[model samples]
Target: MPEYQRIHVSYNGRLGVPVGLFVAVDHLRRAGRLSPDDEALWLTVDDWFIANLPEPPQYSDGNTAGVVTWFKPPLPAAMQRRVEVATGLLSKYGVPWSISESDDPGEIVYEDDFQVAVVPPVRGEPSPMPAGVTLGPTTGGSKQSLGTDASAAARRHLAYYATELADRANRPASPDRQRQLAAFIAQCEALELATILEVGCGGGRDGVALQEAGFDYRGVDLTPEAIDICSEHGLAVTVASAADLPFEDDSFDALWTMSTLMHLDGDGFSRAVAEVGRVVRPGGLVAVGLWGSEPPRRRVDEHGRLFVRRSDSQVRQALSRIGSVETFETGQWYDDGEHYQYFTLRAT
Candidate 1:
């Protein structure tokens, strides 16, 4: 018989040592010294064992032959030497072992050459689409259907045109204007909300207005440059579309999307409205402001970027499927060569 060296193993805090024992076991099994069906495999490093070949059956009085329960102190040096010899012989035979603790080396829990598998956490299933909703085929495709101008120059040109459209539509608030708007939003919500979500927050002007009024606000915009401007001014904003917001459902108590849906037309607008409704909890207030016009109206603003112009009735019909609508059309008249309709619809 070949002489084998002995080693001691110990561990603390984690299961790293047990994994190591599994590795050592793999080597011993390969050398034919350790049988695949060995009963010792059932005993863990936390369990004590005698080194004799018959596995020294676990019971002390030798009456019973099951595995031992507790470990006792004052193990004989010869028994310890036998354990060291077993571990060392396994090691010399290129076997792998796993231990639970690092300080004492003889401890062995599991040993195997095969792969160890880990189970990942389970994720919840996606929510079902709402009633009366129709999703187009291209909605889930990996291609960009919109904003395809072919060339980089064309894309830049179109982007510039969009920016100009956004700018021409820009109506900055006077010093007292934002305060009144904030008050209006708070009144509509029926209470002071600590956190607010603003989708399609153009330029983040309204978001800033709300933040200044003491609400912790996060705004998201589709236009990257618009989001950049909002961030430049020290606002928490991100470039994200409203229809596919990067947030969990029902994450906010209040949502404010001001005059922002005019850009979305037809089914796109309807879907976005429904998505917003899904994200807001029951009885949560959503204040929507939009430019109103009769249906079948589409116009390119001064910058030549197209926008949908919907009447009050069309807007109501589109969103009513998701929540109750309370329309607020400001009677303030403006004739800047463009029809300006303001509404504040409350989502039930």
Candidate 2:
């Protein structure tokens, strides 16, 4: 019963609010129920908590159909203050609240250094993502292993780019992104590659580079806004998803998908990779860059988007099913032990 024993934190224990209070407030704002001033008021602590805590996969895209997250105790002073600020908002908003030492909430669907998301017993059904979710040195578990197709998960990702990342789309590639483009271009030239198709080519950043490098280039993205931005620069881009590209078989000599496939997993991932095989001729090149490295999980990021960080081994296993991996590289490990994974494969 030691694991179930309660440990009091800086406040008490009410990290669960059908979802986190933070997520609920976000929904409220979206629904036009919460005022901007009031919402901004609560965002002070909401920002801190999200920046400090681990987000449960169930709440990815702010969906909390099942699971409730509880704060893991022995709180840091700074984090404790933030939680208190959050609790204060709960009071101000007139959201009924409570504090309990009841450590046994229910089934532990997710856990980490910062919190645990559980299926409280009174809830009749299993969590939407009851398969389990965790990150950072913990055992990996998620809906991905069950082979559930989350093709729809990319909707939030597209919206994120259309709004929060619109400016980024319009800007030139970041220095690191520039490096990725350079590497991919090198691979293309080495392969005598031509007729490139860039998947998820937001604002055509990489498309422009590929064309300038003297390769015939075309691109596709699901976000209309991003397509518009790319089109403004006179880049040839069509709205499309990686899982379902509107192109002919063996349509290109090479393909590039950078920081895009990480948003998809399960069947969505499989289909996209399959599309890669379908579009590129045998012996053609495919380059992938993802800001992720872990056993695949549907964990939410600080931005509240579904970023399925997949393990290098799993990614290779999948990619190898369609091609032979010829190059492999990774960026410096992040604070949470994840990293940027990049690789090039020759289609079979």
Candidate 3:
């Protein structure tokens, strides 16, 4: 048997270590090394950590034999305990490992021959890794640099979504979204609108569904990768920003967008709404879906993207400038316990 080597795994305050430990525990379970009670405990702890801890910015020196991540300082004591438990589990499995606050190698050897795997934390299912003792070359450093500038942050957010297209595609449509789509399709049928435009149609999920529902649907999104995925599915999509739509005036009978306009700030939001008004014909309908708040504010999501929360009154005020607000409601539409605001408006 090849000798197990002592490897230094660097982790900031994120859940990368616990996820790795999850993999390790799974390996032991498959090999019949973990008792039922211990396996349950490991899984419970892993779930707790994943639910409570924010995902860290993922990094790995591909050629190295360990994980790399960066975290904000003043790590909480609870999180530290979790990390200790993860490392303890690894030690119990006879995998020699150590945690470092910094990524500097100092004296530890992280060569390609060492049995280390640097797995990044992803939403949904854990990404698979090679079986048994296997090592792969380390790729380059972190793909993105953390920053606070609004424009740069927005760009990074789009890039992140572009990369996450596959993951999002695998996820089932949210119940609230399905409800919204059903309502929109009914409205289109009532209005006798044969053509519809979907703004910010990520991955073209809604577009495909709308087409199947017998409406001529065209989609637009800022991310090229999302557009590519939509094209592969045979949906008509264009790469364009909502702030500056490329269609002629009054090009469509109705427009539908959801959870996308929230990415724009106040000024960008106004511009995009103006573009929406310009694209839909007189007496056409527009359905807007967004997360709601009484006091509007801007915040960064887990993927380092900017999101603007608007109140129901604020949404009405914005859309009222272009037409009449026919319907408005806010409710907890997802498991996150946060309410989303949905509005249906008639273009004057």
Candidate 4:
């Protein structure tokens, strides 16, 4: 590999001192965390260090002889724990650390010291930070609670949607839509899937189907009304945000999220995706359905229900790095007199 160099680091407000990359890496090395054979990967500094290292560094898994590699940016956050989250390996290196068994040799990307890396905002798009919304360098401790705000907002949105469903039920899934859903389920059955977790499950319609079809599953929604409705019918359900699923890691075999993720605008969406990957087992499958729209359209419907809609392209881009995506299509669903677009995605 080309000489391994430059890693990214972001400084959060609380850390008090400025440190460089090599110094931080050396500390981990001396502490016997990173292997001694690895040299300080050159780092490019912005507000953070964007380090370019190997795919699965040699020091990674303590194989010291692992391939020398580089990354202009640190590995994405979801895989950070396994790789490492050096706040600034070049800096003072006061960030927290965690350890666990590794499932794959290539899974060695981490956010060391830097708990998370901000994905570049969509091309040429500068999203003015929302008033009162503060996003900064993350610490391992802080990341556990990363999407609390958006998840809270998401819950409220889900509640509104549930009420809308009860007060004015959308026409049942069309034969075509139901067929599509069933076909997806059939594919899962072929895989002998044992469990499914649905986030933003509204009124438990799909969950009910999954359960009736004999699939082991549980669901959560941001809105209590939806959870209550599902519970009354004796379905397993919880009122919680997508970013903060209460389940243990790798708790399920597959996950299904529909028309839910689009509600998160920027980094919140990314964090929620990370949470999904964290909670699902390696090689587990994930399926998502979203409405296709450009940017995110915020509006209130005639019944005073609010929605955050994004174009198909935007949804695909947001999820691109996480896994391979298949089956994206736009179709129409009739809800009363209105037409809604349905865009679906599946990844394993």
Candidate 5:
């Protein structure tokens, strides 16, 4: 059976936010204009959540992880009361609001007795960052209350990277990743490719390699924090989703995206691959990687995560929509027991 879930839902049809963040938006909006009474009520509810629940990392990190959380259904009497109180305040303010009471909310990040966090698929391109709304490197101590400046789409896009934690710094590339990099370079060597675009370039770790190889390396990622990190290392990485690369069609010689597409499951995944095909020149090479299974597993599990492992044939089948899969390989990421899948495809 699908798991029952409860969340302070957004109206965008795919995204949901916790009630705490929702209320924080209204409370902060009012507090800026000197509404002390609303501030007091906000404190009343905020204190309860802070004391009773473990705050999700996305909230603490200014939601740079691009994830929002949901509470499982069948709330305890104490918790249900808080939900009621939160709704009452929204009603009092005449603010639009909703509750998601259903199974299969989105791709869940983690779930426990109290709540489940999810990265819901975004509807269209993420909204441009509002002026004066800057994201920076942050510690784990503060909760950034959402303000009216950000749109629901912007919030969902932010939630997309919620699972990519802070530790994805410019660390040394693993041996398996290094080997995969060499393989990609070798595949492009005979063709003498010049420019490469990395979709979802995390921490510029691999972009640094491609740059050092004398290729003009450019990248795009959804997380602004990640863009900041990657740029510090002199990589020209921007903030954009894979489904919506900012470049024109047939712009680059090749593309590289590793372990990134899986986060965008179902239609989101397919659309991104098509977009990937759109940017790279026809007949150019594209390298794709993911943590996957050997026998070709592809399905949303009971927990709502897009768990996957595609056999080489299945991988070829997936790429057939846009190109021909030339070579495919899988190796266990020895540090963890999980398997890593790689593919080199020729854009059509």
Candidate 6:
């Protein structure tokens, strides 16, 4: 396994820091100087910094503080050489950068008008910060909320989807999803279940099918526009979060969510699943669908929203924590060669 290295990329002050940083990182990846994992780390760190970029200290005129840090993964010797050769590339685009090395994790080894500080990771230690870089204070001593960021991203995604709702509604449901829905309905029928809650029911595509199949369905989503669209079709819908469903305990006999929980990170996913368990009666059915990959990872979409792709075992393990996973499967659900995992769970 290749060791990871932290590369803190900072600028004095700039308007398009995130976009510029992304361009540089993508250039390195395209030139084969950075691996896919390296690119992912770079983007993740960039997103973090962009999301948390501090306000200028005390009446500063600058629009941004203009400092960002990233943790770069270990590069092979060849890649390192390529990177060295490409050192002056960003400067061509008017983004000057200085490179510095550090053995201690989180120590600022160097600083100049342009600095790229490198720090090694210390196992089991809280993440380190370079010298003189302080994250803003937390409110009420509570940890900084990723939830806020997630909600903002969710809003942006939903807003984008809102503009395409008609096109999405006309698209046929994936055959795998159709089969999974059929199987879940069969199980619900066997248990004489009636009420169903569909979380993240964007345009009510599947929700309409569930209602047509004689289930009492209620759909919830974070996007009001989506809810409005669904409601126009005579579907019961509301705006809500999967992590904090407004329904009471044992309020539903079954829960269905797809391509939704993946928007959440591991902790958020777990909390949402726990909430699912809470609102669902014991032995109620749950069907979860998400894109899957080995070792579960996060990636930013074109809209800058973070999505986690879970492995089959990872999905099963997560569901097992809340209930028994009665069925687990995966298939190519899109023409784009992307595979999706579906799990049928029985709430404990």
| Model 3 stretches astray by more than 4 angstroms | 1-150, 333-338
Per-residue lDDT for 231-301 in model 3, tens only? 77778876567887879999999999988888888788999999999999999999999886766667887
Provide the global lDDT of candidate 4 against the true structure: 0.51
Q: How well does candidate 2 score on lDDT at residue 170?
A: 57
Cα deviation at 259, candidate 6, in Å, is 0.8
In model 5, what are the clashing residue pairs, if there are any? Answer: 65-161, 65-162, 66-158, 66-159, 66-160, 66-162, 67-159, 293-309
Residue 157 deviation, candidate 5, in Å? 9.1
lDDT of each: 0.49, 0.66, 0.65, 0.51, 0.65, 0.62
Q: How many backbone clashes does candidate 1 have?
A: 37
Residue-level lDDT of model 1, residues 148-215, one tens digit each, is: 23222223323553355356336676544455476666674466556688887666678777787777
lDDT for 71 in candidate 2 is: 67
lDDT of 6 by residue, 85-159 (tens): 234334333445554444443544433322333232332222343355433322211122422332345545654
From the highest lDDT down, the ranking of the candidates is 2, 3, 5, 6, 4, 1
Residue 133, model 6: lDDT of 44
**TM-score of candidate 6 versus the correct structure, residues matched by position:** 0.56
TM-score, cand. 1? 0.49
Q: Write the number of the candidate with greater lDDT, choosing between 4 and 5.
A: 5
> For model 4, how does the per-residue alpha-carbon lDDT over 74-155 read when each residue is reduced to its tens digit?
4443223213324323332344322211223232344333232222222132234335644333331212132233233333
TM-score preference between candidates 4 and 6, better one: 6
Q: By how many angstroms RMSD does model 2 differ from the true structure?
A: 19.0
Clashes in predicted model 6:
0
Query: Against the true structure, what is each candidate's TM-score?
Result: 0.49, 0.54, 0.56, 0.50, 0.52, 0.56
